[model samples]
Target chain A: MVAPVAVVGALFIVYPLVKLTMDAFTQGDGGFSNFAAVFESAAIRNSLVNTIVMSLVVTVLCVVMGASISWSIARARSAAFKALLWAALLLPFWMGVVVKAYAWSIIFAKNGILNSVLDQAGVIDEPMTLLYTRLAVVVGMTYTMLPYAVLAMNPTMSRFEPEFLNSARSLGSSRTAAMVRVWLPIVAPGLIAAAAIVFAISIGFYVTPVLLGGAETPFMATMIGDDIFAFFNYPRAAASSVLLLVLALVVLGTALKAVGSKALKGGIAG
Target chain B: MTHPPRKLLAAAACALALTASACGSDTDSGSGSDGSVKLTIASWGDPFTSATREHLVKPFTEETGYEVDIVDAPGKFVANLEAQTQANNVEWDLLDSTSGPDAYIAHDRGLIATMPDDVKERLLEELPEDAVTDFGISWSVLGYVGACNAEAVDTCPTDTAGLFDTEEFPGSRTSISTSPLVNLSMAEIANGVTIDELPTHEIDLDRAFETLTEFQDASGAWWSSGDQNLQVFESGEAELGISYSGRAYGLIDSGTPVEVIWQDGLYNPGFWNVTEGSDNPDEAWEFVEWIASHPENAAAWAEALGYSVPNPESFDFIDEKTAKTLADFPENREKLGLMNYAWYVENYEEVNKRWQEFLRG
Candidate 1:
C-alpha cells in the first residue's frame, strides 16, 4: 500500500517536475541556454523583481495583520469570543481566490463600493487610483494570505500563558516595554515561520494578481502563463517555472534554518 | 455566389461508405446500436460549442446519419493537435471555429487535413470565395473595436486616433493589455498610419510604444478578457476603452449606456478545420458544407455567439440592428483593418518578448 501511494505521488508530482526541469535545460545549445534566455529578456527580469517585491510586501502585510488577530484570539477573556475570532479568521475558506479577487476589484474600482462610500463620506473630491496597480495586487494577496499566517501563528499564541506578561508587569516593566521584551521574543519564531509560509505561497500566486492587478503590475506567474498560452513557448515557461520553484524553495529552506523545522511545525501544529 | 441546392453531401458520403472506408480510415467509427457512424469534433466549448450544437451539429445529425462528439478545447487547437500528433492518437476529426492564425500554424505543422473536394466545391458555392482556403473555411468573424461608456462622457471617439486623443474625447480610457499586436496596430493608426496602409505595415516598436504610452496614460484600467472589458465599463472604472464588438453589443443589450465604434476595427475571424489523421473527414466536410448551405442556421449560430457567418444570405435571417453590429457588416468591413497574422506568426517570438516587457513596464 505504501509502495502504491509513493509511486502514485511520485508519478503525479515528481514526474512533472522532472519533465519540467529537463525541458528547461534542453532548450537551444543546452545547459543554461534556457537560463541565459530567461536572464536576457528584460520583461522576465522585471517580472522577477515585481514578484519578489509584491510577495515581500504582501508577506509583511499578512504577518502584521495575522499577529494582531491571533493575539486577540489568544488573549480574549471569553472562550466564546475566542471561538468566534477563530471562525472569522477561517472565513476566507468560504470564498475562492478568484471570487475574493473580483470582490477586491469592485472595492477598488473608481465607481465601486469603496470609492462611492469614500466620496459620500467626503474623503476626497475624486476616487483615487487603486485598481490594477502594485498596491492593489499587494492588498488582494495579503487578504488571501492572512489566514495562512494566522493559522501558523495561532497555535504558538494560544499556548502562551497570560501569567508570563503579568509577571513582567509586576517587575515594574511598563506594559509596552513588557510586550516588546517578553511577548515579542516568545512569538518571534511563529512570526518568522508565518512569514515564510506567506512569502512562499505569495510568490506562486497567479490568479489574484492577474484579476486584481493589470499588465502594469506584471508578476512572474502572469509572464509564465503568457509564455505558455499566448506564445506557446513551453521551454521558456518551464525555465521561468524552475526559477520560481527555486526561489520558493530557497525561502522555505532559509526559514527552516532560522526557526528550526520542529519549532515551525510546532507553531503550525500546536 | 448562389448555392445549387441544399442537399447535404455527407448523407451521400455515408451512402458511399466504401469510398470513405477506402481512405485507410478507422474501420469502426464507434458506431451506435443502430450501426450509424459517429464523428468526434473539437470545439472551443460553451457558449461557442453550445451555439454550434443548436444551429449546426444537431441539424447535421438530423439531416445526415452521422453523430458528432464535441470536446471542449477552447483556444487549444494548436496545442491539442500538437499533443495528439506526438502521441499518434489523433482523436478529433474536426476543430470548430479555430482561429485563422491557429489553423495556419496547424496547417504549417501538417496537423490539419485538407478538405474533401466535394465539400470544398459545395462550400465555395455560398461562402465568400476568399474565406475558403486549402486548410479551412472562415466560419465566424469578430472585431476588436472602440467602446465607450456613453453616460460617463459627453461624446465618444468614433475612430482609433480620436479614442487615443485624451484632450478631444476627455475621459479616462482603457485598452487591451494582453495583445501587443492590437495595441500596436491601434497606436500606429494614432500615429497617422492610414487604414489602407495598415494591412501590410510592420509595427515600429519605438514609435508605437511612444504613442501607446500616451494611450495608457489616460487609461484607469487595462483589461485582458471579454468579461473584464465589460466589468470596467459596468463598474464605471473606465469611461472610454477598447472592447470586443460582441461584448460591447452585449452591454448595450443589457441596458448599459455603452456605445460601440466600428470604425478602425480589427477583422478577427475563426475557421472550421478538418484535422490530420481524421477518421471521418467526409463527415466533417459534410458538416462544413451544411453550415454554408443553410444560411438561416448560420445566422442563428452567429447570433448566439455575436459573430458573423461567411454567408451573405445569412443577413436575411438576422435582425437589422444586430446585423449591423457584426464584423462583416458592409459598412464596418469597408473601414476595418485586419492584422497580418502571417507577419505576426513570423515575428511572434521577438514581438511577444517585447510585448511582455512593455506590459510589465
Candidate 2:
C-alpha cells in the first residue's frame, strides 16, 4: 500500500514539475528568457535579495531565541514551569497565520496598543512608524518561526546528559568555556536542523509580509503571486517558483548532510 | 448514542458527499428534479457575494423556482471561465459581479454569450440605455474615492489633487497599492490631467508617476484587499487613503469613524453576463432581469451591502441617510468620474509592470 502510494505521489509531483519546467522556458520569448527577465529587472532582483536577507534575519532570531526557550524548558526543575514554557512555545501554533498577521497589525498600528502603552509609560513623545515596514515583517516572521525552531531543537536539548556539564566544569573548565566546548557540539545538530526549517519556512512566507510589510516589502513569494494572480504571467511565476524550490532544496540538502537525515528527522519530530 | 460501525461509515460517506459540492453537482444538476433548474454563477466573494446571495439569488430562487449556487472566483472569473470554455465544459451559467472592463474583455474575446435582442429589450426596460450592453448588463456601481479616518486626522483632502498636498493635509496617506490605474489615474487628475484628455483613464506616465512617487512618499500601509482597507483605517495605519465607497461606508455603519469624499472620485459599473455555453442561459438571464427590475430589493441590498443598485428606482425605497452613501446617488454621481477600464485593460501589461516597479521603489 505504501509503495503504491509513494509511486502515485511521485508521479503526480513529476508530471506537474515537468510541465511547469517546459512552460517556464517555452512560455517566455525563448529558452532562458523567463530567467533572463528575472535577472534583467532590478525590481525582481531586489525582491530576491529582500526575501533572502529577511529570511536570514528571521532564522538567526529564531535560532537564538529557540535555543534559549528549549534550554529553559529542559532545565526547568518544576513540572509546572516546564509545562508553562511548553505552552508559551506552542501558543503561535494555535492561531491561523492571517489572524496572527491581523493581530500584529492591531498591536503595531500607529495609535495601537503598543503605542498607547509606550505613551502611558512616557517612553516616547510620538508614535513611531511601526506598521507596514521591514521591521514589522521581521518581528511577525520571527514570532511565527520561533515555535517551530523550539519544537525542532527540544528533543536533542532535553535528551542530553546534564552531568556532562558538571563533569566539564569539575575537570577545571569555566562555565562559559564548558558550555562552548561540550554543550555546543551536543546540540549543534538540532540547532542546524531548526535553523534550516526556520529559513525554509520563512522563504515561503506570503501573508505576514504583505499585511505587516505592505507593498514596499514584497518577498519572493509575493513576487511569484503577483506574476500568477495580478499580472497572469505564468511563465515568470513558474520560473520564480522553480528558483525558490531549488533554493529550499539546497538549504535542506546542506542541513541534511551536516546533521544526517536520520538525526534531522528525529530532531524535527521531537 | 453512538451508531454501529457500518451505520457510522455510511453516515460519514453521506456527509462527505454532501459537503463536496462538485461531487456530481457538475453534470447531473442540469437535469435535477423538482423542475427548479440549478444554475451556478461565479461571484467575486464576500461581502459582494453575501449581498448578491441575499438580494438576488434568494428572491430569484423563490420567485422563478430555480436553484442557484454561488462560487467565489474573485479576480479569476475571466481566466477560469476561459479555461473551462477551452476545455469544452463551461461550468458556470452566469458571471455575476464582473467588473466593467472584465465584461468588455470577455465579450471581446467571445467568452460571454451575446445579449439576445429580446433579453436586451427586457434589461433595457429596467436599466438605462448606456447600462445595457450587447454582452453585459450593468448590475451595480463601485466607487474608488478618497476617504479619511475622521478621528485620526485634523484635515482631509477634498479633491484628488489635495491628496498630494501632504503639508496642508498633514497625515500619513494610503491608497490601493496593487493596481496602477487607481493610483496613476487619480494621480493624473491631481497632476492637472482632465477627464476630457483622459476619457479612457489613460495617464500621462511621466506626470502621473511624479505625483504617484510623492503620494507614495506621504503614504503608509497601502492596501491590496477590501479587508486590508478596513484594517488600515480601524487600526489607524492610515489617516486618510483612497478607499472603496462600499467598505468606507460599511466602516461608518460598523462604527468606525470613516468619512468618504466623492468629489473627483473614480467610479465603475459591475456587470452581469451569461457564459457562452452555459447549462441554463434562460434561467441565468431571468435572474439578471429579476435583479435589474426589483428596485426595493436592490435598495434593501444596497442598505445592507453599502453598494449602489443600477436601477434609479432603488433610491426611492432607500432611506435618505442611506441614499447619500450609495454609489449612484445623484449628488455623489455628479461628482464622480467614470473609470475607462477599456484603456487599462488594453495597456495592462505596461501598467502592471510599472505598478510592480513603483511598489518595489
Candidate 3:
C-alpha cells in the first residue's frame, strides 16, 4: 500500500519538479534558451522582486492580524464576543477571493459603491481613487490570506495555557508587556509556521494582484503562467517555476530552523 | 478486536467514497459519443462552447450522423496537439483560435493541416479580399471598444481618444493588463495617431510604450477574466473599459447605463483549423463548414454571445428587430476598424517582449 502511494506521488509531484529543474538548465528552440530569456529580460527580474516583496508584506500582515484575531476569538469572555468573532471569520469564507477583490474594487473604483456611499454620507465632495493602488493589492491579498493565518494560529491559541500568561502578569508585567514577552514567545513557533504558509501561498498568487494592482505590479506565478501559458515559452516558464520552488523551500527551511533552534534551547534548559 | 473488521471495512468505504467524489466533477458524460465519427472541437469560453453545441453541432450531427464533442479550449490544447501530431496520435479534429498566434505558430510548426477545399471555396464565394489567409480562415471580427458607465458619465465617450483623456473622463478605466495589444492600440489612438497611422504598423515599441504610459496613468484596473470585465461594468466599478463587443452587449441587456463606442474599435478574427494528425479530419471539416456557412446556425450562435460570426451572409437572414438587439450588427461593423492579423502573427514574440518591458517600466 505504501509503495503504491509513494509511486503515485512520485510520478505526479516529483516527476514534474525534476522535469522542470532539468528543463530550466537546458537551452534552444527546444532547450534552455527559454531560461536564458528569463534572466536577459529586465521585466522578469522586476516581477521576481515584486513577488518576493508582496509575499513578505502579505506574510507579515497575516501573522500579526491572524494572531491578534485568533487570540480575541479563542479567549473571548462572552459567548456574544465568540459569536461575533466567528461571524467575522466566516464572512470572508462566504465571499470568494475574486468576489472579495471585486468588492474592494467597487469600494475603491472612481465611482464605486464605497465611494458612492461615502459621497452620500457627505464625508467628501469627491470619491477617493482607492482601487488599482498597491494598497488595494495588499488589502485584497490580506483579506484572502487572513482566513488561512487565523485557522493556523487558532488551534495553538485555544490550547494555550492561561496559567503561563497569568504567571507573566503576576511577575510585575502589564498585559501588553506580558503579551509581547510571554505570549508572543509561546506563540512564536505558530507565527513562524503561519508566516511560512502565507509566504508560500502569496508567492504563488496570480489573480488577486492582476485584478487589484496597477500595471507595474507583476507577481512571479502570474509571470510564469503568462510566459508558459500565454506566450507558450515552456523552458523559461519551467525555469521560473524551479526558481520559485527554490525560493519557497528557502523560506520553509528558514522557518524550520527558527522553530528548531527555539525548541533545542528550550530542551537544553529544561 | 470485536468490531475491528467492521471498522476497517467502514473506513475503507469512506475513503473510497471521498476519492470517488473528488474525481466526479471533471468527468465527461460520454453521452456525446455514440460510436460514430467523434470529432472533438475546443474553444475558449463556456458561452461560446454552448452556442457551438446547440446551434452548430446539434444540427450537423442530426443531419450527418457524426458526433461533435465541443470542449473548453485549454491553454495546453495547441502544445498537446503538437505533441500528439509528433507522436502520430492527434486527438482534436477542430480547434478555435485567434488569427495571429494560432495561425502563425501552428502553421510554422506544421501542426495544422491545410483548410479543407469546401471551407476555402465558401470563403472565396462569401468573404472579402483581405479576410482569408494562407493557413486558416477568419471566423469572426473580435473587437474592443469603450464601454462607459452611463451612471458615472452622462454621455459615452464619442471617440477612442476620450478613453485616455483623464481630464474629460475623470473616472476609473479598465483594460486587459496581461497582453499589450489592446492597451498599446488604445494608447496609440490617445496619442493623436489615427488607426492607419499607428506606429506599431511599423512595429515601433518605444512609440507604443510612450502611448501606453498615458493610458496606464488613466487606468484604474487591468482585467484578465471575462467575469472581471463584466463585473466592472455591472457594479459601476469603472467609468470606461476597453471591453469586448459581446461583454458590452451583456451589460446593455442587463439595463446598465453602459454603452459601447463604435468609433475606432480594434477588431481581429479567430479561425477554426484542423490538427495535423486528426483521425476524423473529414468529420471536423464537415462540422466547420456547417458551422461557418449555416445562416440560421451562425445567427443563433452569435446572438447574445461575446462573439459575432465572421460570415457576412448570416446578416441578411437576421431580422432587423433581432439585429438591433445584437451588439455587432452590420452597421456597427462598418464603423469599427480591424487589425491586420498577418502583420501581428509575424511579430508576436517581439511585440510580447516589448510589452513585458513596457509594463515593467
Docking class of 1: acceptable
Put down candidate 3 lDDT per residue, A59-154, tens digits, no spaces. 899989888887887778777767677667656754656678767777777667777888999998976767666788888999988866765555
Q: Write the per-residue lDDT of candidate 1 for residues B1-361, one digit (tens) a residue.
A: 1110123223322433553344342222232456567788788767888998888889888888688778777666787677678778788888888876677667877999887677778778888886788878887888888988888999988888888888889988888777778888888888888778887888888898888788777878888887888888887778987888888898898778888888887777788888898876777777777787899999999888889887999999999888998988888887788776667777777777777777774
How close is every model to the real structure, measured as TM-score?
0.90, 0.90, 0.85
Runs of candidate 1 with Cα error greater than 4 angstroms are A266-270, B1-37, B114-119
TM-score of chain A of each: 0.94, 0.95, 0.86
lDDT tens readout by residue for model 2, B1-361? 1111343335434543463433232232243466658898888778778988998789888888777888878877777776687678887888877877668778777889998899899888888786788887776687888888778888777877777778788788888877677788788877776654555656677788888888878887788988888877877778887988888887887888877888887776788899999978887788888888888898888887777778898899999997887778888877777666678768777777877888883
Complex DockQ per candidate: 0.23, 0.30, 0.27
Q: What TM-score quantifies how close candidate 3 is to the native fold? A: 0.85
Candidate 2's TM-score reads 0.90
Predicted candidate 1 versus true structure: per-residue lDDT over A17-76, tens digit per residue: 898899899865678887887888888888899999989998888899988988887777
**Residue A32's C-alpha lDDT in candidate 2?**
88
The Cα local distance difference test for each model comes to 0.80, 0.80, 0.70
Candidate 3: tens digits of C-alpha lDDT, residues B110-148: 888887666678766655545566656666456677888
